[model samples]
Target: MKPITALFAATLLASATAAVADDNLEKLGQFKTTGASPEIPTIPQTGPKADAIKKTLAKIKLPSGFKISLYALVPDARHMAVGPQGVVTFVGTRKNKVYAVTDRAKSGVADDVKPFASTIDLSIPNGPCFSKDGFLYIVEQNRVLVYPAAEFFYESPDVVAVPIVPKGELIPKDEESYNHTARVCRVGPDDKLYITLGQPFNVPAPEKLELYKKWGIGGIIRMDRDGKNREVFVNGIRNSVGMDFNPKDKSLWFTDNQVDGMGDKIPPGELNRATEAGQNFGFPWYGGGKVRTNEYKSETPPANVVFPQVEMDAHAADLGMVFYTGKKFPKKYQGAIFSAQHGSWNRTDPVGARVMVTYLKEDGTADKTETFAEGWLTSDGEYLGRPVDVAMLRDGSLLVSDDFAGALYRISYEGH
Candidate 1:
């Protein structure tokens, strides 16, 4: 072959190698496959009907000096994360989409609700959390993705999703189930990303215990923002859909939904606290708190199993929770935990469907649990709305996301 022909062949080989490298990088960077951008879904622009919403609001009971108002309409709003600037609030869902509730005028209420990152293929994208530096992290059923400057780029249709944890990495693909699939995420005080992966069974089979423990199922897992240094933070939780780090002690606190087969009054739901790593909260063995599960009643339980800080009503379906550090509410509300009980489906009489406040002592332990807001569940056993997650705006007011009503609400305090 001629020298020119040989040189051309070498150049072609170099180009091919570079192309392969670029493809690899794209695959590793995004959660989805390359060249597979899906059409963005159309989000509903309208909110709930005024008369119906007002009627439901009238039924709600709150402590004196507090008021609740509809903030925005977000479909399937499961968990929420407020942006650093308090401009955009990202809402996630068990469905395949996320939303952005924008407060453009710096008002407490949102001006617009729009679909966010609709191009990405999200599986049970229910947890949205933001870092102090403006990076948004989302926890899907089997992976976690990060969006840098998400608040600014959220409006752009071309915003990219960087996969911190690749697909099928959080759990085995075959083990995934619709039940307990929605994972909640939070950026802890130490700047690590923490996520809860609920075990997919009502009670995990005995044979699967080793695999579940190895994968950190039924527990909380933490990792660096880049998805490195992953480890289980806590174990033995049944299905915790909400978690937040205490602003005072930086200890991790969460809400765990108890087993269902037991009577409605037994195996109460839990508001748990983890002060140290590797703590086990007692699941399968003890359904919630100290209630021994029938499946594990005969087996020897693990020693040093941690109990809940507060035992909520059984079948309350406790989901999202946050530690109140804002000043908008009364001074007494500071350091309190505001949680959303999404309500139960299996009980003879449904409970929850309301917001709960767990007042905490100075030492960061729960003092007492009380209903902060109720009336979503009517006396006749109808649900007008089911609160899923609780979030706080910069002005110190609270935002509650209700998936049943497909709406978000704001709670503020005005002394009489």
Candidate 2:
């Protein structure tokens, strides 16, 4: 990828564990520790609801039998994750902060959005989620921090990590690295872990570049809790801010951000299915694999990798997706995918900033997509908040984390 400006290409932060062994194909990233203490950065206050929050969500349209509510309004809530125990946690890093919200209170709204743990300077976030044991994990620009959910909350706000980037895998000093962290993470059905690290930039590193040839830096990778046996699960993903696996088939899925300026609709974001172990979806070279307007289409074209299973609009910025395993909706939604469209600015009128439900065929292909939840994006371009992540409770109610609103919204089917 071409080198960007200093601000956009901020200094590479600390790289936690990447699936690499420094073999012939490994150039692990290392974040040189700085002499700075982590202080709670000022949380970006929502200020106050400029208008009734409903006015923001009012224009959104959705399928029948679905309803949305203003769960709670907090601050800059970024990403979120839910554990088997029903405890939910999320991160917002405009000022390097983290929070935990729980449904245990029974109101189905986030009562308290409190700090889980954080650092003094990191501004980016990897989103948050957990393993079955109630261990919580949050990611900053360069590191993925893990903490026990129960221990971190109620008992103590301090989070003790299970593991961070191991000692030897740091990126060599003089190499170009993207460290585009903050890719979403989820636990696959096989009881293993999977996470996304975005493309270094919109394009792949120039050919024959040592760093690119070494460990594949700009794509998604899978690993175990020990951070061992790491491997690139997919490639050509410019960014996958939102992701989740199908609970039914155990297939890997993610939403890759679109390549910018490709018009308003051509290179839509991607909803991909990692069919095989080593699939490479087309990126930089004709996103969504369509052979139009995408300039790189003429490039040699990758022969080995699978394209996305579904295509969303350009700059839709689909951030989080979860398969509906709950019985709350019609039986047809048994395994559908609900994606949160964070919305976009570079576009003319705005495309995302709502939840989309992609209808899934038995074979795992997405046949149709619909608006499951609306109101985040406005027709006039004003938004109350951006929904970042989606998770289903044990009772099948759905929880959506709104970074713009700084609260968690729960959607449950009350009608019989």
Question: For candidate 1, what is the lDDT?
Answer: 0.86
Expressed as tens digits, the lDDT of each residue in 314-396 for candidate 1 is 99899999888898788878889999999989888899999999998777788999999999998888899999999998888
Candidate-wise lDDT, in order: 0.86, 0.62
- Candidate 1 clashes: the total is 0
Q: Model 1 off-target regions past 4 Å? A: 1-50
Tell me the tens digit of each residue's lDDT in model 2 across 356-409. 889888787888988888777666887767877787777787777777766566
What is residue 237's positional error in candidate 1, in angstroms?
0.7
TM-score of 2: 0.80
Report the number of clashing residue pairs per model. 0, 18
